[model samples]
Target: MTAIRLFGLAALLSLSSMASATSFVGTTDMIGRALISTTDGISDLSSSLKDDKIVLAARDDAASFVASQGEIRGARLHAALQHIRTQAPQLNASDLQLAEAILAL
Candidate 1:
């Protein structure tokens, strides 16, 4: 009975260690992918916001008026505006101006 008890304890420890070792490898891979995805998402969001700022700033009153009229005609532009609303702040300024620009566009 004593020998059986000792064998059981050893088996439990061995299984526990093996399970831990396998999970550590899997956890490392998952963490690595998450970090890469976060970095890429941030970069893409920043670039897009910068482009929107440039387009808005570069345009004159006439172009802006045209853009304002564009709301109905341009579904893609509207979707881009939505992306800006959702993603711009975490990358840069959480500003009233940014919100207004999205609405105006």
Candidate 2:
């Protein structure tokens, strides 16, 4: 289990753009915590993210958004965020948070 978690963390790091450790650490921690959280809406969204075609199609946008810390809201990323908000109105996480979640998936 520890090996699997380490592999997952490694995979996550590979997917990332190698942004400063400080910035991604908090976001990575948030994504890790969120994945195990019991929050209904976010849980649903988090699971759905794995198969979300819209988000999948916007992987580059998500990477950019996360790397830029919400500074770069690419068009597809914006649309994906809108889609998530529409599906889970109760989820109060900011755009950067949502982007990190999407990127983590």
Candidate 3:
């Protein structure tokens, strides 16, 4: 009985850890998608990207920002991208694309 309990506890802990990891990855992906949508100038790029779920997630992230902070344009967009870069330097490629898009705007 004690062994079974220990095994169950271990399983629960493992499942919890997996959930946490998944949440982190989802958040990171959301940030990356938001950057892509911002650069591409499309709120719903899922049709273009051929991945409805992922693109929709990206749109949601971008929309969240717009809802909270008004429209993102000009210096505000640049500042937001900079802050995202600082927070996730691993997303450098997306940052470059965003920078190009900002220049075009």
User: What is the lDDT of every predicted structure here?
Assistant: 0.54, 0.79, 0.51
lDDT of 3 by residue, 1-105 (tens): 699999999999999999999999999999998777564452222123333332333443454444555344444455546554554454434533433322332
Question: By summed lDDT, which 10 consecutive residues of candidate 2 come out lowest?
Answer: 35-44
Better of 1 and 2 by TM-score: 2
Better of 2 and 3 by TM-score: 2
- Put the candidates in lDDT order, highest first: 2, 1, 3
Q: Write the per-residue lDDT of candidate 2 for residues 21-83, one digit (tens) a residue.
A: 667898999988875563455657889778878888778998987787678878898898899
lDDT string, candidate 1, 3-92, tens digits: 999999999999999999999999999999876765565556545555565334433432443556533324444444456656554544
Winner by lDDT: 2
Candidate 2 Cα misplacement greater than 4 A, ranges: 1-41
For residue 98, model 1's alpha carbon misses the true position, in angstroms, by: 13
Model 2 TM-score, 2 decimals? 0.58
- The Cα error of candidate 2 at residue 6, in Å, is 57
lDDT value, residue 69 of candidate 3: 57
Candidate 1, lDDT over the whole model:
0.54
Each model's TM-score, in the order given?
0.39, 0.58, 0.39
User: How much lDDT does candidate 3 score?
Assistant: 0.51
